[model samples]
Structures are given as structure tokens and as C-alpha cells.
Target: MADPLSVSANVAGLIGLANEVGKIPVNYASNVKSAHEDAHCLQKELTALCHVLEQMRSLLREEKLQGTRFEETAALVSVLGFTNHQVNELYKKLDKLSIQANKNKLADFWERIRWPLKKDECDKAMEEMRRLAQYFQFSLTAANRLDFLSQTK
Candidate 1:
């Protein structure tokens, strides 16, 4: 069985990364004109993902799964761990496109004017994120209805 506290920590980390990625679209929007619609779509996806994560975090806290050792708990933890990895990778990919505030004004201006992600890449990322968010939400709902402690015995 997975430790609930540790799983909660993973959820927290993913939430933070999601928030960081969400901010990128907004920041980039100020400088990039061509990607306005894409940025808005990405932002909405991130916001939805973040909302799901926050709900999961609250579920973890309210349920206090520490004393229960069950198969379902393990499965939930697995999903969380995998989602954490995916979100981290997405953050890295998006972060690379971010312009640093300390960079040369001209360089910053140019970087901001250009959106680095190709259309396919943006679509793929958004699709994957949407899928993961829905999966996590399903897992959370299942977790709430199941009795893990009895199953372990």
C-alpha cells in the first residue's frame, strides 16, 4: 500500500507545477500576438487540471487514508505518481519557452513575440493534460465510495 502522506505530497507538487505552467500562457500572451487563441485554450486546460488536483488533495485530506491498506489505495497512488511525472515534463517543456525578465530587452522582445511550441505539440499537450485530469477525477470519485480497510482484510 502507498503512504497517504507521500501521495498527498505528490499531489501538492503537481498542483504547483500546473500553476506554474498556467501562468506561462498569460505571460506569453502579452508579447505573442499570433498565439492568443492557443494560449487561451492552454490556460483553460491548465485551470481545469488544477481544479481537479485541488479536489483530489481535499479528498485525500478528508478521507485520511493513512490507516487503510487496500488495492484501490495503491491504484490511486499509482495514478497520482504517473500524473506527477507527466505534469513535471509538461512544465519543463513550457518553461523552456518562457522569456527571462533579466534578458536583453531586444532578445526578450523577440522571444516574447514568438511562440515556441508547434501546433501539433500544443494540441498533444492539451489532449494529454485533459485526459489525465479526467482520469484523476475518476480515481478520486472511486476512492471516495470504496471501503479500502475492509478490502485489505
Candidate 2:
């Protein structure tokens, strides 16, 4: 497995990014259709990350990293702390945001608020987001190879 700490930080980052993508207000949206598409992509990525977290937690319980480098472990600790902060901040922002669909009982309200205007711009942004996520995954996997090699010694 990859350095769980590095993956954890990126997972946190992905959480924040996914939250932002998921909550893009209707007034701020470029294209409603693309927003929906992005939401689907983000949802899938979040689900995968959740599984990764669970796996890492399970493995750590079964195999203690007694031989791991201290510096790497320290970095992971820092990432976990920062991830904690990121989650809290996201919750606070979500709490403060009002959803009019609740009182209006309007099904369409959600659709409106979710997708704004400027369709092309929205597509581009979504594409960039996907690329960034892929980059993080690639890096984590590469690092994991190193981690796996170390374990053999």
C-alpha cells in the first residue's frame, strides 16, 4: 500500500474539492448538464476514497509499521491533523448555507441552483478537476510501490 499519510492528505483535499464541486450553486453554475456530470464523477471518487481509508485503517491494525521511516510517519501525522481541520471547516460552511428547496417544496429548485450558465467554462473546470484527481492517484500508487518494496527488507 502507499504511504497512508500522503494518500490521507490527498483524500482530504479530494473531499474539499468534491464538496466544492457538489455544492456549486445554481447562480454560479456554468452549465447545469455538466454540473450533474461532474457531481457523478465526484461521487464516484469520494466513494473510492472512503474505501481506501477503510482499507488503510484495517491494514494498520494488522501490520504495525515498526520499520517505517520516522520522517514519513511524522508527515502522515501532520496530514491527518490537517485533514481533520478541513472536514470541520467544510461542515461549518455547509451548515451556514441555506437551501431554499426545503421550504418551497420545489423539485426544480435543486436543478436550478445546481447548474448556472456558461456551459463551456463549466466543462473545462470539470475536466481540470478530473485531471488533478488522477494525478494524485498516480502519485499515491507510485509511492505505494516504494512502500511495498521497503516492507520486503
Candidate 3:
């Protein structure tokens, strides 16, 4: 098995890519291009890392040796924390975004609504906006729903 710190370090690197993506100026053509390329690269790397993590998790689950301490495993799990509440909130947000995306997909919606928009440009803008809105809504809904559940309990 790989050192716990190595797994943590890789996770940190993946997070760093997310931070960098947040900082990129999406309004500028060149910046958008750069951000897209960076995002694609990060996605590839993170997917590979996810496979590695899954394998490690499976190994940990399969091992049933007597007297095998679980403190390290517990600590590792803590480091990779995302509670059930958080996941539930995320799902809600995704649902909302999916609705918004459907709305944006209507033909001539942007032209009839927003100003100074070509059909192609409007479609592109709406597509990107819908994607981002859904992503954010998912995160927000997940967090809020989890919070609500906790409060109720």
C-alpha cells in the first residue's frame, strides 16, 4: 500500500487544480482556452487518481486480519471526508441545475430574452451558464439540505 501522506499529497494537488480553475478569467478568450485545457488535464489526472483511491479502499475493505489496527484507516477516512449530508445537498443542487439546463436548451430562448445575441453565441453562452449554474446549485443544495437534516434530528 502507498504511504498515507502520498495519497494526501495527491489529493491536495487535485484540489490545487480546482483552485487554479476558480482563479482563471473565463470572460477572456485566451483565458477561457487556457482554463479549458487546464480543466481537461486535471480531469484526466483526477480520474486516474480516483481509480487508485478506489483500489486502495477495496483493499482496505477486503483485509480482515486479526489485530490489524484501524486507527490509520480511520484517520485516512477522516482526511477524505464528505458526509452523507453533504452528498444529499449536492444531489438536490444537481436536480435544480438540470431543470435550468433544460430551460436554456429551448430554441430562441436567449434571442427572445437577452440583448445583442446571435443564435450560435446565445446557445454557447446558455450552455456554459447552465452547466455552471447546475454545478453550483448542486453544491449549494447538498450543503443546505444536509444542514436542514442535521437541524431536524
Q: Tell me each candidate's TM-score.
A: 0.80, 0.41, 0.31
Report per-prediction Cα RMSD to one decimal.
Answer: 4.0, 7.5, 15.9
Whichever of 2 and 3 has more lDDT, that candidate is 2
TM match of model 3 to true structure: 0.31
Per-residue lDDT, model 3, residue 30, is 37
Instruction: Give per-residue CA lDDT, model 3, range 2-105, as digits (tens).
Output: 44444445445434443333222222223233333433333343344344444443433442322344453564444344322232332332223123333456
Clashing pairs in 1: none
Best by TM-score: 1
Query: Compared with the true structure, what per-residue lDDT tens digits does model 2 show for residues 47-100?
Result: 454444444444433345434433434644555455445444433433322344
Residue-wise C-alpha lDDT for candidate 1, range 1-153, written one tens digit per residue: 545566667788889988998998887786566665777788789889999999887776665566655354476777777777877777776775675765488876666667667788889888988998898888777875685755877
- Please give the ranking of all candidate structures by lDDT, highest first, separated by commas: 1, 2, 3
Model 3 ranges with Cα > 4 A deviation: 1-35, 65-73, 82-153
**The candidate that achieves the highest lDDT relative to the unseen native structure:** 1
